[model samples]
Target: MNDLSGLLGRVGERKDILLVVLLLAVVFMMVLPLPPLLLDILIAVNITISVVLLMMSVYIGSPLQFSVFPAVLLITTLFRLALSVSTTRMILLQADAGQIVNTFGSFVVGGNLVVGIIIFLIITIVQFLVITKGAERVAEVSARFSLDAMPGKQMSIDGDM
Candidate 1:
């Protein structure tokens, strides 16, 4: 029971660290003074999600859990695209390219953002998998050690009788 509690506490600590990092990174990105427009919002959202995913990868302590990384990236990318389309429509309806760029920077591309997003997603997934696997290996060894000691404990108890 104590062991389990300690494990849970450690997990919680890691989660807290991840959350803090995500929050700080997102806040910093948002403070860059970009115009309060759709593209700026999308960029902020994507950066936040990516940082969160990266932090999760660092904290999960196993490679098998890395499967979650790609999923996160996919969701973020979809949101980014949806936001981009709407932002583009609004910009076209309201102002010219210079105004849009002044407000949101050159976030819109001829589909390059999507390609870059995909590449980043793939890289994150791979990195997460590797780290998760390493953590799993360590866990496996610890479990085995505990399992091996149990019978010895039982044997000692039997001898005491």
Candidate 2:
């Protein structure tokens, strides 16, 4: 029991170090040439992270409860963009990307390069215009409401005083 507690405590203390290491690894992937197998694994991990983020956003009770969401969003976006650049480099230089890219390119686009590119563009636009914009609007409205309610709240405090 003591050993397990000590291990957990140490792990908790090293979380920041772990995060830095992970960030460095992502940056390294952008510069290094990863094998197809590793690329596939990273792609799968990216998809899993995205799904987990979506679930977290859906199940969170309030925006304040997930205050780190914006940071998480930025990190994930950077990670994905790095992955895209790495994959593009592989495709251009070696003519082989990875299983995940090949599967998506083939299955989603049916081997039509133009259609695949168009679909990717459309999805990006929708995500930005619909999902991101909606979240921003909600945050703006919530802030305005909070400000509007402040006078009433202050009055209540004054009455109690």
Per-candidate Cα RMSD to the true structure, in Å, reads 14.4, 5.3
Rate residue 94 of model 2 by lDDT.
Answer: 92
lDDT of 1: 0.65
Superposed model 2: Cα runs more than 4 Å off = 1-9, 117-161
Clashes of each: 4, 0
Query: Against the true structure, whose TM-score is highest?
Result: 2
Spell out the clash pairs found in candidate 2.
none
Count clashing residue pairs in model 2: 0
For model 1, residues 1-161, the per-residue Cα lDDT tens digits are 99999988887879867656655544544343333354565656666877887798889867786876765565566655555555555556655323444443444333477766777689899989998998999999999999999999999999999
The C-alpha lDDT values of all candidates are 0.65, 0.90
**Residue 31 C-alpha lDDT in model 1:** 41
* Candidate 2: worst-modelled 10 consecutive residues by lDDT: 17-26
Each candidate structure's TM-score, on Cα atoms with residue i matched to residue i, is 0.33, 0.68
